[model samples]
Target: MTRGSLRRIPLRIFSGLLFAALLDSQALAAAPPEVPPPYIAAPAWVLMDHDSGQVLAEHNADKSLPPASLTKLMTAYVLFGKLKSGNLKLDDRIDISQQAWNAKGARLFLRPGSSVRAEDLLKGLIVLSANDAAIALAERVAGSEINFVAEMNAVAHRIGLDHTVFMNATGHDEKGHAATARDLARLAAALIREFPEYYRWFSLKEFSDGRITQYNHNALLWRDLTVDGVKTGQSHSAGFCLIASAHRDGMRLIAVVLGAQDENARVEDGQRLLEHGFRRFETRLLYAADIPAVRPRIWMGDQSTIPLGVGRNLYLTLPRGWHEKLHARVTVRESLNAPVQRGQAVGTIALDLDREPLAEFPLVALKQVGEGNLFQRTIDKIQLWLQ
Candidate 1:
């Protein structure tokens, strides 16, 4: 084949447990169409499969609405960055300002004109959804809530939260403070994936600040053992909102509920969304980064061949019975030359399920290749001329 032309090749068949699972899935493949996803009661909601980053179900996911205290998810993400970069420390004492002390809605009740540890303040922000704690942490990290909110908006843009706008760190009722359910779901997933170390604090049921104790506003943690950390919010204008995450049997799902009727409605909406995702879909790992499933020939190079595969963990989320219909194939560009770098795109790995397009990922070189020897190069040049 000429340069830039594609040569198609099949991947080796699976064996062992994966084979058995696929064989089992064959029976389920011909079943009736999947049932409709659960109906969410909130004004906006999203259910995301964490492993695959796929939206299983959503309603009004892109409509801008008040996030209420759920805005702290972004605030916590910012603070976690400061902690990781050594710009701030958990033990650092933050001097309380009048603004923080007077922050209404939810209060941590920090002593007037006293200093508090950054770690404790985080606990209050996440578990208690305390407005005062959000202000204090903002001041500690960015010198003031105003500056911290700027940092928050910058981070939001950097992380692909294009539909969100943060007016305050505490998620108070501001005229312009808004985030879509889809954006909030992405934000929650980012917090879980980027800061596993700090995410554990969100699961705390209760936190004590010497004089007072407050319980986490996310009620799903108490109702379901599988449910873990996430923030909750309620305001006169925003209604009730919850971003709930739950893990079961190695699979995790994130559910975002916004503008629910009441606190109980938010929890119920979020839980049902999570349940719908785990029950209807399953996430599978297809390939690990740097591990090649295909090795096509390489011409006029130091190496005779190059392995082609994904550059990151490749995952697919599908209905429980569709695994048997998922197929992967590679199409490599022909007549590849020398000096290919590791991780450079070489071809395309096309994925299809039930004979329909699912996703496509770049098949990359698993190893580098340099020029071939002079003698080998001369012979290859002659062979190329003849062809």
Candidate 2:
């Protein structure tokens, strides 16, 4: 039964949808393909729609492999947290150690027994892919690189990077240190979403310490004006890897290319993947947070009904012009009685594209509804019993 046909506690199946865009099948450019045509030539790769949390294209995305210098992404993530929490400051000077000075793969030319500003170290790690800067930042935060590695792993697991294991902060070639393409994509998304203020640093094409200047290894910054900050990695084992993010026409996409042939190939793979996502798919805003999708009866409450909605702005991504077949079915599992608190999950809203399940989200109370007075409760009870 449809949501509107029922007078009693009802299920909101999409006989009539809450969103008109889902049903409006206007010409939205030619459909790209039923599936993302194979174009990328990497061991593993993924293209994600950042707004909808959807993977538009992926290949062997779950296979764990060394991420190389991309491990520095995690180092910056942890350090940004320290700065955000006021435990550290950009101007604060961090002491460099001999071990960090001896960092093997890449160096920021940091010297032992000398201190550098946190901001400069951060730029070095981001712009130059500096191993020495990664080590120094880790030591400054966690007393040692080993301890910092533990923190990195903990954060990884907590943030749902199940296939990842970080052995160092530098993304160096180390045994037992690997990350899946999908996990790395998620990490980049998290870094951007969590630290937007600091994330602008990734877009800096070049960083200078007055004495020396180095350019960012991520070539897309120069090639594509739409592309912004992200990272790149290379190693003998991992070959080459890059995670790039681009914003265009109010949509953002994250593309991950791992185990590529060379630096140029990785850049090409990233650009191709991002272009594929933007060209092939479209993201739509489904529901704004705290806005009611349905107002269900709240028996024995101060109010007659409570507005139920999502906790955050809801978005859906699908192949171009395919939203015509989308259906959002909401099922209210609870009786939806009084004393409902704001943000309480009352039911689930499920989505189906062409009758195939696509996504689901919790339907939450948008505002509090207190219990009714004695007279109101008595009347509601009688009405409920009769019904």
Number of the top lDDT candidate: 2
Q: What is the C-alpha local distance difference test score of each model?
A: 0.81, 0.82
Q: What are the per-model C-alpha RMSD values against the true structure?
A: 5.4, 5.8
TM-score of 2: 0.88
Best prediction by TM-score: 1
Clashing pairs in 2: none
lDDT of 2 at 111: 83
Question: Candidate 1's residue-wise lDDT over 120-202, tens digit each?
Answer: 88888888888898999899878999999999999999988989999899898999999999899888888898888899888
Worst 10 residues of 2 by lDDT: 15-24
